[model samples]
Target: MIIITKNAKKYFNYLLNKKKIGTQIYLFINNPGTQFAECGISYYNNKQFSNDNIRIKYDNLFIYINKNHIIYFKNSKIDVIKNELELQLILKVPNAKKKIIKKNKILKNKIINVLNNIINPQLKQHNGYVFLIDITTNKDIILEFKGNCNGCSMSNITLKEIIEKKIKKLFPEINNVLDFRYYKKK
Candidate 1:
C-alpha cells in the first residue's frame, strides 16, 4: 500500500487530464530487492489492466500495481516538493532497496540444515565447510566456502560434483548451486 500526499494527489489529477485515455496511475519498480532497484510512477490506461495488476480507487483516480512488485511498494509514499522554482515528484520507498522478508525462508533454512548435517562433516575433514548464503527467487542456492576450501581450486569440483549433486537429489526443484566469492585471506 502507498500513501499519496495531498499535493501529490492533485498533481496526479493534473496528469490525468493530459492523458488521452483512462484516468489511472501506475506504480512500478524495476530490479527491486537489489542495489539497482528503481521505483517509478506512470500514467496507466484501462486497456492494460489485467490479472497481473491489482487496482485501488484513490479519490478521483485509480492506481494499479503489479502483483509481483507489490512487496517493494508497501508503505511507500509519493509527494510533490517545490524547490528553487522546480516541482519534483519524490518517491519514498523503504522496501525498494531494503527487503522486508525473503520469499522462501522455510526452504532456505531446510537447505542449510541439510548441508550442515550431511555436507559439513565431510568438508570438516579438510578443515573446510560450505554454508548457505542465500536462496534466489529462482530456487538457485548461493553458498560461501570457508577454511582451506576458501581459495582452493578444487572448490569448483566440490561445488558442481558433490554439493550441487547432493542438493539436486534432495530438492529436485532447485536449479543451480553457486559459490559466493570472497577475497582471499591475507
Candidate 2:
C-alpha cells in the first residue's frame, strides 16, 4: 500500500497524467534504506546498508519517513496519509536486523572545525574553501568545494589526494571521502 501525503495530491496527479496510457509510476518503499529528492525532480529511494529516511517535495507537497519505522514494513504499501501526506507503498522483505550505527556527530563537528581552521586557510590563496557536508557511520565523509575549486579541473585530485589524505591521517576512522560540489556562476 502506498500513502500519499495531503499536499502531494496535485503533484501525484500531474505525474499520473504525464504517464502514457497504462504506464504506471513505480512506487516502492525503501525499507532498510532512505531516499533523497530535490525540488522539481523525480522522487527516488534506495535500500542499502543503512536505513535512511525518505524525503521528497513537489510544490507544497512533501513526503518523509522515519528511520525507526522502516523495519515494520514486510511489503510495499502506498496510500495517502490522513489525506494530507502522500506516501508510497512499503516493500516487505525478510527483516535484516543488521546493526544500525548512529552517526558520530561529535567527531563530525571536530572534523568540520579542523577543515575550517586548517584546510580552508591553507587553500585561501586559491579562492577555495573546504566544507564538511556530511558524515556517515561507514566512516565516509562528504565535502563541498567552493570558489575557485568549484570548476577547477584538479578539484577531484585535490579532494582525494590532498584533503582526504590529510584528513585520514588525522582521523583514521574516516575510510571513505566524497566530494559534493556544485559550481556557482559568478
Candidate 3:
C-alpha cells in the first residue's frame, strides 16, 4: 500500500508530461551499506524487468518493486516538498527501521549456520576455511578465506560455482558470495 500524496502525484504527472517519456517508474530500497536504507526511484525502460518484482498501477504511472521489499514498503507515503527553489520527494516509511534490524539478525544467523554445517566442511578437506565477515544489505555474503584457501588458484571458482550455489540453494535471498582475498590481490 504505497500512497502517493496529492502534491507528489501532481508533480510526477507534470514531469512525465513535460518529458513525454513512456518509461515506468521503479521504487526500491537501495541498501549500499551506508548505515541507512534509502528509497531509490529509477526510470525503467523494461530492459531489466524481473519476475520477482511486484507491478503496481497508480493513477497514470506504473511502479515496480521487489517482492521481498514489500514488507518495509507497506503503508509508505510519498510527498513532494518545495523549499524556496528546489523540490524533493520525501518518503515516510514507518516500519522500515524496525524490520531492517530484525531481518539482519535472522539472515546473519542463518548464513552462519549454513557456513558452519555445509560450506566450511567441504573446504575443510582442502585444509582451508572461510569466515563470514559480513552480510551486505543486498544479501551478498562477504567472506575472508583462511589457510590454503586464502591464496588458492581455485578460490574464485570455488567461491562462485560451489559456495555461492550451495548458499543460494538454501537461502534464495543470498546474492553473491564474495571472497575478500580476490579483491585485495586486484
Leading candidate by TM-score: 1
| Per-residue lDDT of candidate 1, residues 106-172 (tens digit) | 7887898998999999999999999888887788888999999998999999999999999999999
43-93 per-residue lDDT for model 3 (tens digits): 665557888887888877778888777777879898999999989888777
TM agreement with the true structure for every prediction: 0.54, 0.44, 0.49
Residue 96 lDDT in model 3? 60
lDDT of each: 0.87, 0.59, 0.80
lDDT of 2 by residue, 1-186 (tens): 234444446546666577544332323333343333111123432322224554444444444444454443334333333335655432333333333343486788789888988889978889988788778667788888888988789888888888889899999989977876532221
Point to the candidate with the largest lDDT: 1
Provide the lDDT at 83 for model 3: 95
Q: Which regions of candidate 3 fall more than 4 Å away from where they truly are?
A: 32-35, 100-186
Which of the two candidates, 1 or 2, achieves a greater lDDT against the reference?
1
